[model samples]
Target: DFFWFNPSRLPSPAEWVNVRRIRVKDAVDPLWWMSKSAYPKANNRRVLEKYSDSMIQLIQNGYKAKLRPSGWDISTKFQKDNGGAIPPNLLQIANTESNSWYLRECARSGVRPHPARYPSRIPKFFIEFLTDPGDVVLDPFAGSNVTGEAAEATQRHWIAVELRVDYLIGSKFRFIRPHPVLAVPAG
Candidate 1:
């Protein structure tokens, strides 16, 4: 049943076989004041310096979640001003109030960047595609354990690993049943 072979290892329809992504709600932190409270508007630089690590981690991890940049209209612009080739995928569209900026601010201010969340759909898709009814799935970097929730919904066993203890505990709310948690070895 294999129709295509992608030697480049790019994720393609044929290579995936049954694997796919799922849909879920955006997990951005609901509380907004924390950003300002921790890093006052006046002392933006100070805040940025303090929580720089969190910001870097967020930027690095954002790509894995496939959070396409929001707020640009390339099609509209191409009609009026033609300068550079329009990127086919449009990884990031220009938006004034960008998520990247917000995340960077949050990371710099030591405020958790409203937890850039993944939708349940993402994990659901993967579970349905890659696994059968009883097969197992693993989310090694399970932030809020949304993957576990999706797996549960689709009747697939899941193993979600998170370094932070609080997230591991909070993930229980999202899942109907709890899957066994395994400790990841420290590098």
Candidate 2:
């Protein structure tokens, strides 16, 4: 339901202004501002701070933020049952973990972990919000296949496609058993 790109690669402020101008034309709903996976460098922090300040100003100036009418009742019910407010788009998950199972498995097997692996929380958040328990999830760029792990943990069926065989092999550490269906191109 939500599309997210890594925030580390966001353009500088001047460029982002132009980018926002273009995005606004096609934007129908609120822009969710997700936090970075890792703690941001000073420059990136400054950029985020500026953006946050601008948003605060807009809100103080009486910008009327609207929730989707269809989901309003559902959101209220979710909040009531869950005893927590709906998560703001500014996700605060930390991407770095020195001793995660994935890392420990890679170390045990002497296989290097994927350099660009994102934390499972990112996909887990969206999956919980957007899909029901039995839905099918597809992850086309399945680096370390964290999305697959998250989907399976949430009782969703998943298909993950990764071009790199090494990464795909390593991703298996997250699963209890080998996938029932395995497809590889004939050499």
TM-score of each: 0.35, 0.52
Tell me each candidate's RMSD, in Å, in order. Answer: 21.5, 15.1
TM-score of 2: 0.52
Off by over 4 Å in 2: 1-82, 177-187
Count residue pairs with overlapping backbones in model 1. Answer: 19
> Candidate 2: minimum summed lDDT over ten consecutive residues — where?
40-49
Q: Would you list the C-alpha lDDT of every candidate in the order shown?
A: 0.47, 0.63
Best by TM-score: 2
Error of 2 at 163 (Å): 0.6
What shift in Å separates residue 30 of candidate 1 from its native position after superposition?
Answer: 25
Query: For residues 1-187, could you state the per-residue lDDT of candidate 2 as single tens digits?
Result: 2343444433335444465554322212232323344442212211122235444455445444456777643232222222223344565554456787788898989988888777787777666665678977788889889999999988889999999999997898888543447645459
lDDT of 1 by residue, 1-187 (tens): 1121112232334334335434332212221122224443332221121224544444445423333378543332223222223222111111122344334544554544325355454455446644577877788888867678778888889888889875665554454323446445559
